[model samples]
Structure formats: structure tokens, C-alpha cells
Target: MSLLQRLIARPPPPRTAARVAVATELPGGDEVDVLWVRDPRARRLRLLVSERGARLTVPLRASQREAQQFLDVNLPWLAAQLARRAARDVRPAFGRGDPGPLPLRGQLRPLEWREARLLRIEERDGSIVIQAPPAASDAMVRRALRDFYIAQARRDVGRWLPAYMPGLPRAPRSVRFRPLSSLWGSLSPSDAVSLDLALVLGPPAAFEYVLVHELCHLIHPNHSRAFWREVELRCPQWRALRAWFRGDGLALKAEMKRLVGP
Candidate 1:
């Protein structure tokens, strides 16, 4: 063969498939859908378990057999995680009567509900009192309370940004509040900061830490050493605050979910 023909006839480099699907039976006879994804950036096999099921990400050179073996080794852990998620999915009811003490600004404040002509909320003598229309539905009352929480979070987080990062290059484009499921706060590409309204129900320190964490993201987009160093520079006690969020924060989220029903 000519030299040009020989060069052109060489076989193409081997490439792993982008994604493959498999199924595995759990200990309880439940079948879980496993997606095997070939990620060039993946350094090792990683398992992501969620309510949607588990996904196994492996390096491009890894095999399906290796993926199955990895899942087999971690079946117990996966089962436990699925069990925990199932427990969390069981929603609790929030009665119309006084909902008891609620976390506010790092303390538990008694929550009182009253019916009136107008919707009003007030913090009186370490208690949060809500007054709404006599005929308002539970959803309406919950919305009012949720809005109140958003207002509080907006005020506190707005005040904190300046105090925490006095040397920030520029003020954030905007600060928004919303009901977020799995995040405390996020810094958007448009330079806006979105905070979960539920954060107001956690400890004040935790809220502050979340604010600092997101603001640092404005500088360092990833969770690299530089980002953590910035976080430490702003909130030195951030680890303890994070621990509080991981422990007590779950209770706060559950309570919020119970009250809001989502």
C-alpha cells in the first residue's frame, strides 16, 4: 500500500460510550435504575444516590463489570440512603392551632395565630404573632408567614453583605428571596444573590455563614482552597455554624415544610 493509504487506514482511537443503562435488584426486591456514564473528567467511580435513583459515573476506560462491582460493594450504603429519603418524604401535618415555638434569629420564639380583618404579623416580647382574616385558608396563612420570613431574610442578608465583605468589588446586582428546596443560597451568573426564605428560621450564625459563603462565590466560583480561605477570612467560626445547620437546620427545614406543606 502507498504511504498515504497506510496513514489514512489506521484505526480510530477507542472511545467509551457516553452513557449506558443497567438495572439492579435491591435487598427488598426493589429494582433500581443505574446509569453508567463515561466522564472524561471523572478521576474515579462515584455513586450519586437520590430520590430519582442512583447514577454511577466512571472514567471513560472503566467497564460495566467494574461499575457493577462498585455498586455491589456499596449496596448497604445505598439502601440506607434510600431508607432515609423515604422517611423524609413522609410529610407531617401542621395543625391550625398555635404551631408552638419557632426558630428566629438564633432563638426559639413562641408563634401565635389570631384571626382579624387584616393580615398582620408582629414580633412582640420575644414572640411572633400572626393575625389574618377570620376566613382565610391555611394556605393563605402559610403564604403570609412565608412572606414574612422572606422579608426578614432580605433585611438581614442585605445588612450582612456589606459588613462581611466590605471590600467587595461591586455591590451585588440584586438580592432575591425564594423558597428553595436543596440550597441555602446561590450566586447567579448575573451577579444576583438568591437566598432561601426558609433560612430566617435557622440560627443567625448559620444565616450569616450562608451569606458569606455565597458572597465569596462572587469572587471564587468553585469550592477550591481559595474560596474556603475567603470564607474563613470572613466567618472564622463557619465550621461550627455549618455543623449547626447540618444538625438543627434539618429540624428547621422540616418545620417549615410542615407549615408550608411542600
Candidate 2:
């Protein structure tokens, strides 16, 4: 009985090969970590590049060699992307005598910092005055500035929300603000609208565009043709506004990063 049972069981067929990963150095001397993933549903190989690094997704039948080959072929593109990311992360030193004005509401507003008993920000005569405590550090001053922007975003977004509501299927249940890293705005399935506080640095037109974009999502959750049509119908100049946000808005984000790391 024991002999027959052992012969029939066959030790669970010796299991398939486990997934593996390896690190390889690019021609530019940058190291890339490659993961060999087994995705049953994957129809073909795909490469994803990000600030962190590059990732290769492969089908179950693919080998580690294939993944490595893909990385080798895409090394140039990967290197350029990594270089751009490195440059983006290198924030300019923000202190006395920095050139130009601070970006606020899509315009370069004069930045004035001074010592005071408490931190306070005020907008007077086309200038943003920031008063920090005597012992306040740069990070502390940055925090105060961020808080000011968040408050400003809240006020501005609230004012703009009402103007776009009549075009939507129904007004959002609520509007909220957050300091988001990667998203300008998002519409929840529960009818809540959340906007990025960093958006306060962008132009008023860009802010209005984002608000309208999220509002359209209340009717069509996906970016289908119908959803975009609705957006175009409501905001005819949305295309230009979007282009401005992508170009100028990114500059604002980089400046904010310089002020407040990450």
C-alpha cells in the first residue's frame, strides 16, 4: 500500500520555477533592478519607467534572459528618464538672494520673509509677505508657506465649485483639499471631490479647469468619449488650460519641492 501511494503521488510534480530578480548596470553606470514576474494574463512584455527605476512585466512563459534583453534594448530611454528625474529632484537652494519672484496663482508674486513673534502670511499690493518667528528654520518657514497655500486653495476652490455645479448631473456631496504628490484632483465614487493644494500655485484658469474636469467625472466616471465631450462643451478652452497646467504647473511643483522636500 505504501509503495503504490508513493508512486501515484509523484511528489506534487516538483513545482514550477519560482520568480526571480536581478540587478544589472546600465552603460551609463546606473544600476537597474529587474524583476521577473509571472503574469498569466499578460499578453506581451511591458516596460514601466518611473522616478524610482524601471520595471519589466513579462508573461509566465518568458525567461529572465528576455527581460534582461528588453532592459538592454531600452537602456538609452531609461537613462534619459533617470537623468531627467535626477535633475528634477535636485532642488535649488532657497535662501536670501534667490532670483525672481515666488510662483503664486500662476503669477510670480514678490516673496518677502521677515522675523516676527509668530508666522503669518499676508497678500498686500501684489506681494506675498511671510513673517516667521526669530528662531524659525527654513523647514518651518516652508511649512507656514504650505499652510497658507492650502488655505488659499480651499477658499479659491470653494468659490469656483459653485460656478461649475449647474452643468454637472448633480453637485458634489462635498469638496475637500489635500497635498497630493501626483494628482491634480480626483472624484470619488461617493460623490466627493478632492483637489491638490499644490494647485493653488497654478493660474486661476487652470484651477477652474481642474474643478470642471473633476465635476464632469460625477456624471461619467471614466475618461470615455462622452466624458471628454461634456468637458469640451462646458469649458471650450480646456485644451489650452490643460497645456498651461502641464507646462507651468510642473514648474510650480518643482518650486514647492525646493521649498519643502518631497
lDDT of each model, Cα atoms only? Answer: 0.71, 0.69
Q: TM-scores for all candidates?
A: 0.69, 0.66
- List, residue by residue over 90-171, the lDDT tens digit for candidate 1: 8555545657776677678898888789887778888989887877777777777777777788788767776855757666
Best by TM-score, which number? 1
Candidate 1: give the clashing pairs: none
The local lDDT score (0 to 100) that residue 98 gets in candidate 2 is 47
Best by lDDT: 1
> Which window of ten consecutive residues has the lowest lDDT sum in model 1?
3-12
Which consecutive 10 residues in model 2 have the weakest lDDT in total?
4-13
lDDT of 1: 0.71
